[model samples]
Target: MSHPIIRVAIADDHPVIRMGIEAAIDEIPTLSCIGAVGDSSALVALLEQSACDVVVTDYAMPGGAFGDGLQLLDHLRTHFPDLRLIVMTGLDQPAMIQALHASGIDHILSKADDTSHVPAAIAAAWANRRYLSPSITQLLPARGAPRAIAALSPREHEVLVLFVSGLSVNEIATRLDRRKQTISTQKTAGMAKLGIDKDADLFKFASELGLRTARPDTE
Candidate 1:
């Protein structure tokens, strides 16, 4: 007996990553790469033009009008609920893991996993089954580490986005109509919840998580 083809779409900000996934999909007999896009806008366009059953997307894909991270996922869920989604990420932050799970994502793959797992995940998703890559399974906090759900509140998210976007505490307070000390406290608390300390690491964390609306405007 034979199975129907599963048309797949790839969404990632990195061209190299997209190409690799495209090649992997091409190698599978039952899987077809319908399109590969570098951002959410192009992904949306491709889906609208082509018939795609599954989407393999990076969690941190930015540079799109729809934005990335939870925002992008929400857009997909709302517009393409039937499409099977496989989220790929490099971060192991418990808060992020909790957020993704809370969003009802079934297949989460860590970038550290071998590319071969991508085919396995695609097959599982096409079958309507949950599949977590080995690396992703290891990253799951349930395996021993405290299952922390330090999800930032709405205000904390806003404060961190502005801070990571290159705004000073005073500037953020002014823009948000909050006190400078309050903004500082929120920023510090957000960093602590994410297990980050230094400013450079905070910027990297925000970028990796797509917390900012976009990349920092200034260097």
Candidate 2:
């Protein structure tokens, strides 16, 4: 039996990137490029009007009804619960990678990496598996390294989990029924315990410790 076609969409600010990805999608037998848009607003509008199985988007795209980065991802996740996302970006920062993972994006391809992996990434996302480009994987803490979560107090761990799961400090405080300052303190303490001084490192640590919102079935 023939496999069902996977309707895919592309969103990137650069026309070259969008067209390149569209061309790649055309080469895959089971994948179809249903829409290619320049901004998140256009992408959202297309999604609302059409059916799409997967979305390959640039993380840093700006000027949309919803702006880019985590804001765009959050909006998409909230509005389209079942849509599979594949992020294609030049950002290979440890913290950003961790944040993407925390936000439940399973397939991430660095723009610097081989485009040949794009098809694989899309397939993996559809299968509920994760595909991280080599550039991103190289930034992860070495496996078997001591996990920072072990050093955290229970409250600190709780706060870190919520924060990495894409909650703002104020939101976390509201959910935990604690003062925002208290939540901030706990977050700081947890990061310190983990030797993490940057926001990205906190996300990296949480991701390494499996503290994100959704765990991938496969790496």
By lDDT, the best candidate is 1
Report lDDT per candidate: 0.80, 0.79
lDDT string, candidate 1, 37-128, tens digits: 99999999999999999999999887999988778888998999899999998767655564565567889888887778888899999889
- Which portions of model 2 show Cα errors greater than 4 Å? 142-219
Best by TM-score: 1
Summing lDDT over every window of 10 consecutive residues in candidate 2, give the lowest-scoring window.
210-219
For model 2, name the residue pairs that clash.
Answer: none
lDDT of 2 by residue, 150-211 (tens): 56677887787878888999998887788999999988987776656788756644544556
Error of 2 at 177 (Å): 30
- TM-score of the candidate numbered 2? 0.66
Q: Assess every candidate by TM-score.
A: 0.71, 0.66
Query: Could you give me the TM-score of model 1 versus the true structure?
Result: 0.71
Misplaced by over 4 Å in model 1 are 143-147, 150-193, 198-219
